[model samples]
Target: RSAGVSKAHDPRHAAKMFKSAQEDKTGRWLAIHFTSHDNPHISRDALEELIQDMSKQSYRQEILAEDDEIQLSWLVYRAFNERTNKIDDFEIPKNWLVYVGHDFGGANPAALFVAQDPATGNFYEFKEYLPGAGHSTAQHVDMFKELTTGYSVIWRSGGSHQEGEIRQGYSSHGWPIVEPKINSVKAQVDKVVGTMELNKVFIFKSLHNRLTEVMNCLWAPDAEGIPTDKIKDEEKYHLSACARYLYCNFTPDTVVHNKSRTSHSMSM
Candidate 1:
């Protein structure tokens, strides 16, 4: 039986459920994937209670912990143990690809993408490419290439003409490219829903960091359900990358007004 393991008010109560599942012959291989929020402490009191409950069970089980830091650590751990092993440490759907940035060029613009798992209908933040404190676009591109040599990438030019400028710059380096066709907020959300539906994808809230920003950044105009302008007036490369993912991945049935009008237009 599948269950979302989290901090339970009563550990004893949760134990009973596990016990019942174990009795069923078909439920012996219980894979309890941890989708709950994990804090710094490896063994929190509440977490220990759940662990203890699982330990008591005689049936075979496995714990697949899923979280941001934990997932990253999992990648490293798997790589170390499975060096030379035929199996890959990480998995992403074939259709899904990385989304590249073309706004702030180097310092502030964020390069991000979503990898939707077709089987589970879940989207992982996949990876992000951010320019460092004093790095140029060329440097960031070089680093990005190094970081994502084998991974498929999807590029986006979303910031009016500025996006065009980013495109020209990255093109010099031969990055696999695509254009952001999303022209409106409604379209952006629609693209998200459609992409999820099209690819059987669900945004992995517990795993993806950008989801938090996406959820927080979106707002309504006067409660009529119309989207207001995106949050701006500062450097938000990472946040913008998330926004662009929503913009590019899904194509909506009804398009929202594309806010492609920005002061920093790329004339090329």
Candidate 2:
């Protein structure tokens, strides 16, 4: 869709323009409106008209009513907006129990660091490591160690897609990584969804790479274009796999108030 050419559309030109937005995202001039039919500003007639028009294009994105112009066919994390919070200048107290979840990638390895608040039983993803390509396992271990220097990293684990050598590489280097206790993909997705619904998970805003993966985490589609349980673009969603590794490994027990625990709330 062009500025004034609704009937005559040029997709190639439109794609080129959109690609520019992706390249330099900081300064873009796109008038984005995120109002749904339930918006209070809409009159009854306007709402009815919007609904009627939406019914015609139910599966496609209603660009005028949403900010995400490209609607994900099957979004993986539905509770990402409501349950997750992002803060610019938040600090993790030294007392919080920290854990790292990792994914050994084909091109590059990635890790996500999460801290558990003993008092509220909430999990916060404070930092991430997703340096793309050419870095060795030893370097990744060193970077992770350096990142969580002061925090008490109780455990670190990941899924190497049954490639024992990759996990072995980390273990031999002294990181001592382990396989996830909850190994099933269904189990991992279920656990993440369950925890998110309970308001126990919050991902920091600083993790740009991780956040980008989360937004693009979509279920793979079948031959008939119906979304299936298998994830689409698995390579691009490596950090998302790290997220699945995270909640599966760190199952928070009932919040037993620790009097000595620092009051550094996971409140964004």
TM-score of each: 0.45, 0.67
Error of 2 at 184 (Å): 2.5
- Candidate 2 C-alpha error for residue 239, in Å: 0.9
Candidate 2 local lDDT, 1-268, one digit each (tens): 5686543222123534555666765675553335454467768786667666453334234424322433433667766652236555389989898878888875877888988887777778888887889887878878888999988887777885586678888899988777776778767877677667667778887887777666667777666445689877776777777878767654434333553222322321
Please provide, for model 1 over 1-268, each residue's C-alpha lDDT reduced to its tens digit, 9 standing for 90 to 100: 5578665432233444555665667856573534323355455677556665553211122233322222222121111111121122265645555444444544455655555333333445555545446877667677777766676654444454336656666677775344556545445545554543433333333333344343233332323323244432224435444454444544433222332211122231
lDDT of 2 at 3: 82
- Taken over the whole model, the C-alpha lDDT of each candidate is 0.43, 0.68
List candidate 2 stretches off by more than 4 Å: 1-73, 82-84, 250-268
Worst 10 residues of 2 by lDDT: 259-268
Global fold similarity of model 2 (TM-score): 0.67
Give the clash count for each candidate.
11, 0
**After superposition, candidate 1 runs with Cα above 4 Å error:** 1-90, 93-106, 116-123, 154-158, 196-209, 220-237, 240-268
